[model samples]
Target: MTPRPRKQVLLRLDPAVYDALARWAGEELRSANAQIEFLLRRALGEAGRLPGAAGPLPRRGRPPKNPGGDTPADE
Candidate 1:
């Protein structure tokens, strides 16, 4: 599947708001940008404002070489 291109947005937040968002994002183990996107998606879903179905999210980070070949049982 072709990856969807993300839109670049410019957002302005108060200093305190930014700090709070950063802290919360850290706690959730997500970057501030990802945390913000997550929140926006949820809010849109709740408000019934979401666009047509989104494709499944692509897995983050590098894909494993040899797929499941790293397990001890396979060694």
Candidate 2:
């Protein structure tokens, strides 16, 4: 099935807060936007407000190679 488009949001944060978030994200190797989403999801889950149908976070980085050691570029 085709994946749905992700929603875009505009957020405003204090410089100090943003800096802290950016640093935390960097430590975790995640983007600021991703870090925000992760925290939001965690909070929602803890509060039992997360939708049952909510999908998991999308995978990051390169896709896995085939067992035959072939990739799309090799095809």
Candidate 3:
């Protein structure tokens, strides 16, 4: 038998807060859950806490060139 998918947990918030979240979610064309997830990701990304998150890194010279030798440096 296949394992069942994990269940999602629901959070209860103050009515006013929930209403605000709902309105923000509607404005962004996302469900409350999706809006929360997006907010969490953005927060983590800003804090450099997300796994495999892209941020500024030390420059390692120019990026690799494509297979063709048509790169500007080749000119």
Candidate 4:
């Protein structure tokens, strides 16, 4: 499956706000950018403003191969 594209945004925050966000993000074990996205999703969900179903989470790493796997004749 093709990967979805992410929109790049330029957000300007006050230094104090940025510092607070960085601290919070570290506490949550997420990058500052990821933390922002997480908070936005939560707020949107709480406000009943989320669009569409969350959908299946993207698979991690390589796709699993068939259990009855094929081996190359050379092997």
Candidate 5:
């Protein structure tokens, strides 16, 4: 199935806040944008405001090279 298209938003933050968020994101190995989304999701879940249809966050890294479980020699 085709994935839904993501929405874009324009956000404004104080320089100090942005720097702190960037540092936290770097420590967690996520982009600042992803870190923001993660925090939002966590906040929603904690407040019982998350939607039932909300999907899990996207996978973080590259897909497996041999997804079909085929040996390289077989190819």
Candidate 6:
């Protein structure tokens, strides 16, 4: 199934929490936003709130399979 488009979200985290997230992101080689998404997915998965297999939320974007079976060079 195709994934849905992403919507912009604004979160107001405490200063300390934001700082810790930034640090964790650096350590994990991920952007702060990515880290936050990962954390949220993990939490949701643990709580069985994920849509399927109790897995992390799917990343928002098209899947790798090309509907027309075309390669990058075809375009």
Please name the candidate that would achieve the greatest TM-score relative to the true structure: 5
TM-scores of all candidate predictions against the true structure: 0.74, 0.81, 0.56, 0.68, 0.83, 0.65
Candidate 6 residue pairs in clash (backbone atoms < 3 Å): none
Candidate 2 structure, TM-score to reference: 0.81
In angstroms, give how far residue 41 of model 2 lies from its true place: 0.2
Best by lDDT: 5
Superior by lDDT: candidate 3 or candidate 4: 4
lDDT string for model 2 (7-65, tens) is 99999999999999999999998899999999999999999999998888877665577
What stretches of model 3 exceed 4 Å from their correct place? 1-7, 53-75
Q: Which ranges in model 2 have alpha carbons more than 4 Å from their true place?
A: 63-75
Error of 5 at 36 (Å): 0.2
Which of candidates 2 and 3 is the stronger one according to lDDT?
2
lDDT of each: 0.80, 0.88, 0.70, 0.75, 0.91, 0.77
Model 5: per-residue Cα lDDT over 1-75, one tens digit each: 566788899999999999999999999999999999999999999999999988889878787688667676566
Which clashing pairs does model 3 show? none
- Better-scoring candidate (TM-score), 2 or 5: 5
Query: Cα RMSDs of all predictions?
Result: 3.6, 3.2, 12.0, 5.4, 2.2, 4.5
Q: Per-residue lDDT of 2-74 in model 6, one digit per residue for the tens?
A: 4566668999999999999999989987778888988988887799886674434454456667655668645
- State how far residue 60 of model 2 sits from its true place (Å): 2.0
| Pairs with steric clashes in candidate 2 | none
Candidate 2, lDDT over the whole model? 0.88
Could you give candidate 3's per-residue lDDT for residues 1-75 as a string of tens digits?
333454488888899998999999899777777777778778988998977834332223355576346676656
User: For candidate 3, what is the TM-score?
Assistant: 0.56
Error of 3 at 30 (Å): 0.5
Q: Which stretches of candidate 1 lie over 4 Å from their true place?
A: 56-75
